[model samples]
Structures are given as structure tokens and as C-alpha cells.
Target: MPQPVIYTHQLTRKFGDFVAVDAITFEVQPGEIFGFLGANGAGKTTAMRILCGLLSPTSGQANVAGFDVYRQNEEIKKQIGYMSQKFSLYENLTVRENIQFFGGIYGLSRQELKDKTNVLIDRLGLHNEANKLVGALPLGWKQKISFSVAILHRPKIVFLDEPTGGVDPITRRQFWDMIYEAAHDGITVFVTTHYMDEAEYCDRVSIMVDGAIAALDTPAGLKKQFNATNMDEVFLQLARGAKRGD
Candidate 1:
């Protein structure tokens, strides 16, 4: 098997006396859709931040896209894409301009930026709205644009923190289609979400209870192991015992 795109061994994080992430270990393969799920403050965000190089781990080891998280954070940033729960696009800029701006940040050359911009606009069926301000577009449009921009650089891994929230069911389904396409193109997707139905779409999922992973397995395996009918039941079975509520 190929080297895992993400590897963590006893990764942990702390805030003063409290342990936000407690020695979690896992691996995510290339083009895999890995779900990181948890309730309010089960340390999911902390663990993800450490993996994304936003926060350093207090102990243990983590390597993302072949770079050490503690020593090569800047390099990790270049090799991965991230989409936060809140939209990260510039509302004031036109759709085309936003794409250009982010693509530029990713170090795309003038011609490369232009080419990518054209391809994205055409692919997303946003030709008519390419020149429109992102603020004026609907939530679904903004979500799609945000996702497109996140992967515009073709990073090895993309971390999505609830990339689909508050949109209609149809829009959510469409958003997932984009995720599937990204994975098919060999982009590893590391996503965190509270949506159980969405969790079922992942290739593998890890559920964090408090500050540790309580379960990690494929959807069907988790269902069989927990004797649950769906992802929702499995999540409830584990998350119900969590000590933290943040």
C-alpha cells in the first residue's frame, strides 16, 4: 500500500491544565474520504487544528503530506487546503476575482491562474455569475465557490470543517458531489461534521468522545460493531458518554 497521506501517532494537545486532544492516532490514505466526528467540544477541532498546522501538538507525532506538523507547518499549509464552517470567501469580490486572489496566494502563475479560473467557472456553471459579487450570490453558490477555491491549488489533502451546513438538502447533495469528484482526482478529504447522514458517505470515520477517539471504522463496520441501524445510532451510543459539552 502507498504511504498514508496523514499519519498521527499518539497525537495530543493541551490548553493550560486541560487536555483538548488526548493521544489520538490514525491514518488516512490518498484519495480517501476520512470523517472526523464529535459532539460540541470533544477535541475534534483541537485535533484537526494540530493536523492542519494551525496549532502545535503538545505531545506525540504527526505528519501531513510528508511534512512534520511541528517543524514544517508552513510547508504543510502549502500542501493542503482548508474550508472552515464559516464561509471564507471575500464577499466584496466578484466570483472570478475571488478565484484569482486565492489562486494567486497558492502561487499559481498568471497563465495558470487564468486557465484555472476559466475551468472552474465553466465547470461550476457559474459563467453568468462570474462577474457578480460573491456577496450577492445565494448561500449554496458561496459554499460551492468556497470549496472550489479551497482545492484550486490541487493540494494533496483538503480539510473541510463542516463544508455543508445550513444549505438545502439538494444543495448539500450537490456539495458532496464536488467532494466525491475531488477525491476521485486523488485529493484526500479530511472532514469534520455533525451530520450523521453525511458521515455515512465517508470511506472511514473516527468518533471523538471527550478528547479521545472512541471508535474508528467504516460505516458498515461501525454499524455492525455497535449493532446500530445507522450512523446516527452509532454516534449516539458513543457520544452519549462524553464528559465535555463544549
Candidate 2:
């Protein structure tokens, strides 16, 4: 078996006296699409923050891309990419400019940037709109552009925080196509979403409730385990007992 790309054991986080993440453990393999699901205040965000090196855990062991979460956060950051639902692009920057800026931040060489920028523009079908400000583009186009840029550096893992939110079903489908391509190219995708249909698309899912993982399995496995017909039913079977969302 391959070493897990993301691993955690008894990982916990707290806010003063309140436990925000409670002894969660999991492993993600390279190129896997890991779905992190939770209701509001279910500690999903807090756990992801710790794994992404944005925050420290109160206790437990974790390694992201072979770097210790407690000691090698800077290195962990280098091995990962992050994208949120908002797309995270500068509204005023032109499409081409945004691509160059983020690629440069990832330390792509000047020549590499020039080459990649052209490829990104071509792949996104943005040739006509490459010079337009990102804010001027439609929401769907912006979403695609944002995802393309997030992985432009080819990081080992990309943490997607509700990457498909607010877009139409068609656009969501298109966004997921990009996600599959990323995974196909060996990028481990860590994603969180409220869409049950989207949950069905995950390689495996871990659903959180009250700061701990309530269920973890392949969608089919989960359906059989819960005796539910779909992810929505499975999620509801667990989420109905959530105490944090109230």
C-alpha cells in the first residue's frame, strides 16, 4: 500500500473550554477525492484549517505530505493548494494577469509562467476573454478559472472548500469534470460540500457530527451500511442527530 498523503490520528482542536474538533482520525491516499462533510459548526472548517496549516491543533498527530502539522506547517503549505467557493481571484485583475500572479507566487520561473499562462488560457477556452478583468466574466467562467489556477503549481493536494457552491447544476457538473481531471493527474482533492449528489461523486466520504467523524466510507458502502438509497438519506440519518447546528 502507498503511504497516505494525508494522515491524522486522534486529532483534536479546542476553543478555550469548548472542543471544536474531537479526536478525529483518517487517511487519504494520493490522487483520492476525499469528501469532508459536516453541518454548520460541526468542526469541519476547524479541522480543515488545522490540516491546511492555517491553525494548530490542540492535540493529536497529523502529517500532510510528509510534513508534521505541528512543526513543519510552512513545508505543508508548499505541498498543498486551496480554493474556496468565492473563487479567490482578484476582481480587477485580467484573466491572464491573475494566472501570472498566482503562478509566480507558486515560484514558477518567468519562462515557465509564460508557457503555462498560454496553456491555461487555451485549456480554459479563455482566449477571447483572457484580457478581460475576472470580475467581468460570468460566474461559471470565474469558477473554472479559479480551479485551474489553484492547481497551476501542481501541488500534491488541493483543498476545495465548497468549490461548487452557488453555481447552476450544469456548471457544477462542469466543475466536477475539472476535479476528476485533477485527480486523474495525481492531485489529491480534499473537498467539502453540502450537495448530497456531489457527495456521491467522492471516492470516499467522512461525515462529521458534533466535532467528530460520524461515518466514513465509500458512497455505496455508506448507503448499504445505513440501509439508505442515496447519500442524501445517509447524510440525513447522521445529520439529524447533530447538536452543534442548533
Candidate 3:
């Protein structure tokens, strides 16, 4: 069997007296779509930042793409792509130019950047809008383009932080299709979403409630364990009993 692509053991983080990530442990396999789910203030952000090497944990260990998050953050950064909720493209830059700038940041050569840009534009069916400013594009197109840019350098894992925050349901479904394609091609995706149905699409999901993972299992398993019919019920079963201020 292959080793896990991401490994975390008792990983923890604290802000003053508050425990933001409370000794959580989990593993992610290569080519897996791992869903990280939680509500506001659930500490999902803290855990993700720690894994992405953007924030240091107060205790425990994590290895992302075989590099230690604590001591080998720079190496980890090179092996991972990140997309946040907001559109990350430069508004003034054209669709093609946004790709060029991000690709260049990854240290791609001029030829490599040009090749990748063309491929991305073609793949996203943005040939007609390739020269248009990103600001002028609609939300769904920008979302697709940003996702394409995130994977341009072929990072082993992509971390998506609420990548479909404000989009309509149809757009979100289309976005998940893009995610499936990326995962099928061997890029492990670590995503967090409030959309329970989206969690259903994951190979496995972990529900975080107030800084701790309350449940970790496949969608069916979780629903079965909770005696629920859907992810929304499963999530609520675990998270609903929590005290508000904790």
C-alpha cells in the first residue's frame, strides 16, 4: 500500500488560553479529495494554515508532501497550491496575464509560463476572453480561471479555502467538477466548505466543532453512524450540542 500523502499526529495550535486546534490527528492519501468542514469559529482555518505552513502549531507534528510543516515550510510551500475564498487574480491583468504572473511566481521559465498559460486558457475555454481583463469577467469564469491558475505549476496538493463561497448552486457544482478533474489527475485536494452536499462529494470528510474534529469518516459512514440521511444531519448531530462560547 502507498504511504499517506499528508500526515498529522496530535497537531495542535493555541491562541493565548484558547485552543484553536486541539491535538487533531488525520491522514490523507494521494489523489484523494479530503473535505475539511466546519462552521464559523470552528478552528478549520487554524488547522489548514498550520498544514499549509503559514502558521506554526503549538504542539504535535504534520508532514505535507513528505516535508515537515514546522521545519520545512518553504519546501512544503513549493509542493502545494492554495486558493482562498476571494478571487486571487489581478483585476487589471488580462486572463492570460494573470496566469503568467502566477506561473512566474512559481519559478516557471518564460517558455514554461507561455505553454502553461495557453493550455490553461484552452482548457478553461477562455480563448475568446484570454485578452480580456479579469475584472471584466463574470464571477463563475473568474472562479474557474483562478482554480486553473492554482494548479498551473502542478503542485502535488491544492488547499482550497471555501473556493465557492458566494457562487450559486449551479456554479458550485461546476466548480466541484473541476475539483474532481484535478483529483483524478493525481492532485490531492484539501478543501473546507459549509455546504454539506459538497462534503458528500469528498472521499472522506472531517467535521470540526470548536477546534476539535468531532467526526471523521466517509459520507455514508458518517450518515450511518449518526443515523442520518445526509451530511447536514451528520454534521449537526456532532456539532449541535457544543456550547456557544467554547
Candidate 4:
């Protein structure tokens, strides 16, 4: 088995006596599609920001992509990609232009950028649309392109925060296919989502309630343990006990 690419021990983050993350512990193996699920106000986002080196934990230890989140944050930043639910892309830029722009921000050489852009455009079947403005594309296509740009630098791990938040079923299905392809190519995927059905697609899932992980197991395991019919029911059962948003 590959050593865990992401490891967190007693990871906690607090704000003025309010603990967003409370000593959560977990491991994500190389190439695994690990899901972090929770309701609104859950500490999942805090934990992810720490893992991505965008935020520091008040206390505890975390290593992302084999680099310490505190001391080696810059290194961690270079080795990981991030795609938010908003699908950040310049509306005025063409599909290929947005790809080129973000790739340059990651310091890809001109030649490297060109090579990767061509490969991504072909792989995503965006050949005809590559020159069109991104603002004109459908949400599904924009999402696909957003994901492509995020990984253009070939980061070892990609943090996806609600990547499929509002897409249609067919588009969501297509997005997961891209995720599966990324995992197959040995890129670890760390994702957070509210969609229980999407939880079923993960290799393993950790569901957060309040500020700590209340359940961590495979979809089948969680279902069996909770005697629930599906992830929606399992999540519903756990979420009922949450103490937040009161």
C-alpha cells in the first residue's frame, strides 16, 4: 500500500473559543478518492484549507503531499491543485486562454503550457470550443474546463470543494468520470460534498458533525453499521444529532 499522502492528527482550528475543527484524525492514501461530507458550518472546509496550506491549524499536525502544512506550506502549495465550487474562470477569456492563464500562474513554461493545453483540449473533447469564450459555455462544460485548468500543472493531489454542486445529473455523472480518470492516473483526490449519492462514489468517506468526524467508513460499511438504506439516510441519521445552526 502507498503511504498516506495526506495525514492529520488531532487537527483543530478555533476562532474566538469556537472550534471549527475539533481534533479530527484521518489518512488519505495515494490515488484514493476520499470524500469529506458534512452539513453547513461543519469544519470540513477549515480542515481542507489547512491541508491546502491556505489556512493554519491552531494546533496539531498535518502533512499534505508529504510536506508539513506549517513549515513546508509553500512546498505543499506547489504540489497541490484546488478547484472551488464557483468554478473560477475569467468569463472574457477563451477556453484555451483561461487554461493558458492559470497554467502560467503555476509557472508552467510557455512550451509546457502549450503542450498541456493541447492535451487537455483533446482529452476533454473541447476541440471545437477551445477558441470560444468561457462565459458562453454551459455550466457543465465550464466545470469540466475548470477542473482541467486546476490540474494543468499536474499536482500530486487535487482538492475539490463541492466540484459538482449544481450541475444536472448527466453532467454530474460526466464529472465523476473525470475524477475517476484522475484517480486512475495516480492523482489523489480530496473532495467535500453535501450530495449523499456522491458519497457512495468515494472509496471511503468521513462525515463531520459539529466539529469532529462522527463517521468514517465505506458507503457499504456506513450503511451496514447504521442499518440505513442509502447514504442519504445514513447522513440524515447522523446529521440529526448535530448541535450547530440552532
Question: CA RMSD for every model?
Answer: 0.7, 0.8, 1.2, 1.1
lDDT of 2 by residue, 114-181 (tens): 99999999998889999999999988888899999999999999999998888888999999999999
Clashing pairs in 1: 40-246, 41-246
Q: Is candidate 2 or candidate 3 better by TM-score?
A: 2
Worst 10 residues of 3 by lDDT: 237-246
- Steric collisions counted per model: 2, 0, 0, 0
Candidates 3 and 4 compared: the better one by lDDT is 4
Give candidate 3 regions above 4 Å deviation. Answer: 244-246
- lDDT of candidate 1 over 168-199, digit per residue (tens): 89999999999999999999999988789999
Give lDDT tens digits, candidate 4, residues 1-246.
778999999999999899999999999999999999998988888888899998999999899989999899999999999998675789999999999999999999999999999999999999999999999999888988898888889899999999998899999999999999999998899999878899999999999999899999999999999999999999999989999972
Give candidate 2 misplaced runs (Cα > 4 Å). none
Question: TM-score of predicted model 2?
Answer: 0.98
Candidates arranged by TM-score, highest first: 1, 2, 4, 3
The ten-residue window of minimal lDDT in model 4 covers: 80-89
Q: List the residue pairs that clash in candidate 3.
A: none
Q: Count residue pairs with overlapping backbones in model 2.
A: 0
